[model samples]
Target: MNFNIEPISTQIEEALQQKIDTKTKPLGSLGKLETIALKIGKIQDTLSPALNKPAILVCAADHGITQEGISPFPQEVTFQMVMNFLGGGAAINVFTQQNNIELVLADTGVNFDFEKHPSLLDYKIAKGTKNFASEAAMTIAQCEQAMQNGAAITEKLHANGTNIIGFGEMGIGNTTAAAALLTAYTNIDAKDAAGAGTGLDEKGIAHKAEVIAKAIAKQGIPNSPLEILATYGGFEIATICGAMLKAAELKMIVMVDGFIVTAAFLAASKINVTIADYALFCHKSNEKGHALMLDHLNAEPILDLGMRLGEGTGNAVAYPVIKSAVQFLNNMSSFADAGVATEK
Candidate 1:
């Protein structure tokens, strides 16, 4: 997918105000939902910004370092969550169903073997990525391939009239991986990036930080973001970065999920700074590193319910607010037509 710079436009903001004043409710009564509508309108360049064919792309993979017990959950949990996603039992499933959003699954680098499920997209890069402590987590070629897989998915969505796209991830030990990447990319100490991923204990958190520090030390090379990702990133993270780049190139409104998703965006933004203009942070994850990451990105998230269950749950939760925004903008009438007072 092309990663060309996208020019920002303000035409839709004018249309947004016209619709907001016409709503039956007093102006600005809806608070954030109104902001959301205006934001979508501006991105889509329409007064009536509809999220027709909204899609959640859930990318799943496994981190080889789960063997080191940095995460409280076992490695098998990765496969279990994938099953939950497929069975419609997960939070993302319910939210998408409620919002009528389409869902797609990409096996970016999971270790488990599975038959063809109707929703699963087979784009596996390897059985799983290598443990970053041992060597580079993925070769540069693998990183590019994962990115291409993400771009391919977006191309299909763009053609199918998907106006908005949100990204989610499923992988054990990934938060640890994200923390490491953030430390490298943002120049934060490994301790700052290290968090209670999957409820790690005091000792586990310390171990996570120490191990990440060692990984960084061992890397020994200049801290380029792409090199950091290729050295220590998860397959899913690479794919998500690719998706963000492609989404910007396509000029589609991007709904960015939590910390890990932001880590991917951070990596991609290093490659092309313009992608940030097309992104809407869905919510802040409760993961410890998330707020710091958002601060670095200067992102104002749509929700802040202290959620951290990475399967795009935050994105799903934020969808209604987006829908309400579009609904108000489309259904509200002009003040002149409604016989309401204008800003005379």
Candidate 2:
């Protein structure tokens, strides 16, 4: 389908200058907002960037490695957490509602069977992926299907006029899986990428790293992101990666969530460099490897409230700043129009 990165337009730069001049504050007074508005304007290729019909798509799945005791939470937590999201009790739900964002929960690979939960979108690939510690986590076909699911979801959201989309994940032990994927993709030591997922203890963290190292050593590094993803990635991570790419193709602003979602974005960016331009990093997560990962990607997070809870919390919390960026650009009037003296 010729997925290529679109270049920022000069019109966006000109519009940004005009918009900033219109605000009560001096031009470029709002440092980050100016940058953000310009970036958004460039992304939408419009002088007027509007974040209409914003949606947070949370992909949920269960990691087979949860059985290995890598995470403090149980695998069942994946479905339970999805239920929590459906119940509108999650941090994501609260923030999404506050921001008037539509929330979508996709069952990518959660193990439990759900009986038609109205709020839940049933796109389950399987009960869950197989154990990667012993073998490949998902087959190539499974990986492809997950990607398609993600693309379809993004396409649906885009068709519904979703201008800004946030990516979140719900899965037990996903950070462990994401860390392992990062270690393999970046060729760093798994120990360095490992984190205290769901509050793992020292011993548990060590064991998790050891297990990841062993798995990576056995599988060997793959030639591409697809192969690597098929080998170690949870369905939720894989889906998020696909969503990032699709969002970029559709020219939508992609707000990345915490560590795992960032990892997914990294994987997608590796496959396509233009993906980085479309992504707005939400925050630097408290996950152990998130800061280093962000540094490696050369990404500046929009906020740093020390958020660690996944489920798109960072993206949701950072919505106000995004809203302000759009609001300032669209609603503010120019100095000449306001009869204000321009500081020459």
Candidate 3:
């Protein structure tokens, strides 16, 4: 729980900027790639930085609010998708494979009892969270335990020399929980926070909004990030929050996926404002309120492919771009080395 995350130092900014500017190209020809290079350099505290052992941790869980019929998909889909992920049939699997990013899956609190697989991590805090529509989604102890499990996973990866970690989540009806958490943290209206999750129709979205509003009324506003998480967060979301905090504490590059993952980051940022300093917002999800959430964080996503699928697909797709950024920084020649004349 004690991440002890520190703010990214600015002392190296001048040196990093100079190195980037001296590249054998126009001052700003690389655009966002240049910014990314500078960021990685600062994160590594070196003029030349390298990305190694890139991995994405996908956390799976089930939401008790699925009982409220917020999503068009059945609760069974949560488990089914976990199976899909294991079977290499999911989008995340394909993208991670295509990009050569290691994919790690965790069963934080899926309702089903999964048979052990070599690739799947077993850290189920419970079968699933309690119905937040009726009460707190998770007990305080469960939330804390979920977060600790997340931190432990990140610690293991960091110890193994994995310095760039991305987070993704899978949980049926989790968007309802995400909406409620967003409303609580940002005071965004319930209707605005609600979205057509998993192909919900307008009427279903309306009803989902009503359910979220009622849950908010019942739980009232939470006093802190921990309280909000315990009151409305899914197991996967809470775990992602803990993982993100640990990644930032370790000064690793944290690649964040879509809506649900962003909700986790929102909570993590509230707990430790410096977490965002080490984060890379991968893309803008088409899901409702996602753009607003990115704006809230003042984050510029690397892509806007209208992607809303979770399970770290965005991070996997964007990993090559992140790698390219680091590559140019370490390999590209300076103007003098390239025998290029400066613009007169």
Q: Whose TM-score is greatest here? A: 3
Question: For candidate 1, which ten residues in a row score worst on lDDT?
Answer: 219-228
Return the clash pairs for model 2, or none.
none
- The local distance difference test score of each candidate is 0.85, 0.86, 0.92
How big is the positional error of residue 344 in model 1, measured in Å on the Cα after superposition? Answer: 9.2
- lDDT, candidate 3, equals 0.92
Instruction: Give the alpha carbon lDDT tens digit for every residue of 265-303 in model 1.
Output: 888888888887788888999898999999999989999
Q: What is the lDDT of residue 147 in candidate 1?
A: 91
Could you tell which candidate, 2 or 3, scores higher by TM-score? 3
Best by lDDT: 3
State each candidate's clash count: 0, 0, 0
Residue-wise C-alpha lDDT for candidate 2, range 18-70, written one tens digit per residue: 66667777657888888888889888878788897989899999888877889
- With candidate 2 superimposed using the best TM-score fit, by how many Å does residue 62's alpha carbon deviate from the native? 0.7
Superposed by TM-score, candidate 2 places the C-alpha of residue 92 at a distance from the truth, in angstroms, of 1.3
- Residue pairs clashing, model 3: none
Candidate 2 segments whose C-alpha is farther than 4 A from its true place: 1-4, 21-23
- Per-residue error for 99 in candidate 1, Å, reads 1.6
